[model samples]
Target chain A: MDILVCIKQVPDTKDIRLDPETNTLAREGVESIMNPFDRHALEEAVSLKEEHGGTVTALSMGPPQAETVLREALACGADNGVLISDRAFAGADTWATSYTLARAVETLGGFDLILCGKQAIDGDTAQVGPGLACRLDLPYVTCVQKTREVTADSIQVERMMDDGYDILRLPLPALLTVVKDINEPRVPSLKGKMKAKKAKIEALTAADIGAEKQFIGLAGSPTQVVNVFSPPPRGNRTMFSGTIEEQVSQLVEQLQPYL
Target chain B: MDYFLTEEQQMIVETARGITEEKIIPQRAELDEKNEFPTSILQDMAKADLFSIIVPEEFGGLGGGCLEIVLALEELARGCVGVATSFAASTLGIFPVLIAGSEELKERYLPDIAAGTKWAAFGLTESNAGSDASGIQTTAVLDGDEWVLNGTKQWITNGGEAKIYSIVALTDPSKGARGASIFVVEDGDPGFSYGKKENKMGIRSSATRELIMKDCRIPKNRLVGRRGTGFITVMKTLDVSRPGIAALGVGLGQAALDEAVPYAKQRVQFSRPIISFQAVLHILADMAIQIEAARAIVYAAARHIDSNPKNMSKASSMCKVFATDMAMKVTVDAVQVLGGYGYMKEYPVEKMMRDAKILQIYEGTNQIQRNVIGQELNKEYA
Candidate 1:
């Protein structure tokens, strides 16, 4: 089982600040961490490789500094790290990201499974995994909560739903965008850290991956984030002051139209 | 303020810091309150390869030196000295083996310690043998193929929980100080048991119990280094370990200062934030200055020990005195800065202050350290 885990290096959301004037995220000086959700994806991939047996490759598409997350992944158990980084991939929306990642995946072929987080913390956009699956024409599952069964040819998983969950099985060479409930990630061990320090990461460029000029970078994306800002604080209120039972009846009567 | 650590040293710091943030910090208060040992956290550290930092690579470790160990100690102590002390005491136990144990002994014990499957502890302090270490009454007599040990070791860190212990006892009482010999004893060995656990002022999460070895039997091969060289090994081990204790003080002082500055800025007293007052400002400034100075000496002392490894008692003692004393003063001021809130258990500064006192008292009391330094000065002048 050769697994490919797609990860992203995003500003640690804990310290993230919004630039009031620009209506955009102010990333300068904030620490960069592997997207929290992607860690679950990597954990799932590594565990699968551990239980069965094969190589686990950590794949990421971002700036050269994004190599940090790949090294972290390698430290956590990934056998190899492939970073697809190019200046041309700047300001890419979800559509362009999926395309660029698809091209990179095509370049690094023989993966029995590809894993990704349901969404990036910074963007909160959950479209890339499904879009890449569409591009590769592979069967895919999203919000994978548990992996019940696995074999060389296929895998059975529980897909989390709002109220319950759905059991689904997909054939080999599939894609999975996992939820955080998949598995707990392990800390990097000394042996693993030593290995990661000495290991060489393979880097792929835009041209090397054969990405077309019109369908890659910011120009390729159809969707645009026109503005990003926190919603205005609401200031409307209706007070119901009485005994517990009286307040409950009053609250219900005041909310009749909405109900 | 940068100590200019190498890449490998920085990695040790970062790895330990990760464990501190992810594991120790969250559980520190509860563990301290309950006085519970950080057994699970130690396991987490083992998984992180923290336990392997100072052991020889041949024995499944990184073979790191004093600087590396101190770096990790500072970070871990920042989260909780109780946990760091438990970790440091194990290294103290390991030192006897590393410094004097034969190839056979090292092969037998260091691997399990490095793996973190079995923790180690050092036992030397008895109720009667504290400041005057040579006064211990524990006896280990040879009986054909075995050695039988008797007497109690008081305030032994990691006492009951640690699987391995390296302890010193009298082998030939007539020889006085030279009569003591160090031996390795397993926890499950017959006739060896732990007495009552101590309720301490700080670092409550680390276990401290009496090691009671009543006619405890061990094979002759368990003797570390040579016969009757136990006192020498004890000195060398303390010489090697003092810098780590100093690092714990620096880390504790820094944690206290870290709490003080932000608190000063936010805590309102009078018309504005208390930091607006000169008295509060001065306290914060002093804490930062003292912590940085303490850190500098600890780094220098550790670096000196790692580079030369000889004639280090004076340098090691200097750091132990300076850093630990600095920690005591700084933690007190941090509490004063926090005022009534700092004295309360709700804030960590109170806990930090409690933890700071032990650093001054252990390894070598600040008074004992001054004596060592004074004696060294007389020798240098002579």
Candidate 2:
């Protein structure tokens, strides 16, 4: 199987701070890590390559520093890494980002399968996978919890659901957005580090990937961020400071409306 | 001085730090309190190929050197020194074989070690021989086609658990240091037994026990180097390994800093965080400076050993003495930064302080390191 994993670098949510005035995240001093879900996607892709004999390529679209995630993927067993970076690619929404990624995929030639994380943690919109699939005109599955089987022409997977899951089989040249349940990512080995240090990462810009300027960046077809804010605190909790029986009766009476 | 790590080194540091945080730190306090060897964490480390980092690739290892060892240990120590030592002592045990063993011997032993399927331990410290290695009483005698070893080795790391042991003993008592010879002893050999495990003041999670070898026999082919070169082999191994101890010290010191800095910022006193006070700020600043200095020296020393294995005694001693003493001071001050809470066992700084004390005492006490440095200085200046 020839697989491509689309990854992103996002600010670690644990250290995230809000810029209340601008209604945006304060990115300063925040460490960036590979999106948690993307890690599972890459892990699944690498395991597939190991099981069958083929190559796994990790591709990402971000600033130059985003090469760190690509290198990290290489260290985790990706056979190749490509970074799509350019100033023109800045201020991209999900539609534009997926459009540019589709162009990069074309430049690298199409793969039998494309894998992605369910969503990036920093931006929890979960749109890029489906958007990219739509742009590529390929069948796609989201919330893939397990890969049942893979062959030259088709692949089978279990799509997760609130109650359980649905098994789906898609033809080759399909896309998948994986969840954390897919697999546990392996730690990068020392030998892998040596390989990553020496490997030359392929860098592509908009022109390199043959992407049109209008469809590639902020000007691309389109959604815009109007405002971002933390939800107001909900003052819906009540505390009963009384003896056990009194507290229980008071709690039951307070919850009587919902009951 | 600012140091820029190579890409490979940075990846190594990141990988080790991840494992340390995920696997080692969470279990450290419970392991210490129970005084149990951290077998699961060590196995996790092995699975990560940490044991293979310094072994030759031909022997199924990563072909890394002293710098790689230092990088890994510094990160591991940040989580827990006992765990780091438990892992590092294996490297110490395997060095004699890598340094002087015949190809046949290396082929026999290193593959299992590099594979992390087995563990190795170094046996040199005896009851009569602490700093004075020449006073070791373990004796090895050639009988027919085998060498018989008989003596008790005290304070051995990984004593009963390790599958392989690199031990030094006297072959000719009259020649003192010249009489020493190194031998590879297997754990399951008849007459090889363990004494009671020591209850240590710190690094308690590591297993420290006595290695008792009474009438233990091995093929003469297991002898390392030659009959009289054991002392030389032992000294060179220590020289190569001292930087690793320094790296552990750096790790502990950095952990202390990691703890104190965060607590200082959030801990309120007198209507403000204590970090706002100049006294506390100076303490934090001093801690950072000291740790950085120690780290720089330890990294430099490790690189020095990697590049120039010869003439590293003085540099090794310098780094070991400086870094370990610095760790002791830094951890103590970290406790002071938190004041009364720091003294409490519930917080981590107290455990860090306990861990820091052993760095100065083991791997050749800081006093012995200074003596080695002074002796080298006399030779160089004269």
Q: Rate the local accuracy (lDDT) of all candidates.
A: 0.92, 0.92
Which pairs clash in the backbone of model 1? Answer: none
TM-score of each: 0.91, 0.82
Query: Which lDDT tens digits does candidate 1 get at residues B191-279?
Result: 99999999999999999999999999999999998899999999999999999999999999989988999999998877799999998
Model 1 off-target regions past 4 Å? Answer: A19-22, A47-52, A145-173, A181-184, A234-259
**Tens digit per residue, CA lDDT, model 2, B1-382:** 5478877677679889977887888899999999989887877677577888888989999888899999999999999999999989999999999999999999999988987888999999999999998999999999999999999999999887799999999999899999999999997887788998999999999999999999999999999999999999999999999999999999999999999999999999999999999999999999999999999999988888889755999999999999999999999999999999999998999999999998998889999999999999999999
Candidate 1 Cα lDDT to native: 0.92
Candidate 1: C-alpha RMSD to true structure equals 3.8
| Clash count of each predicted structure | 0, 0
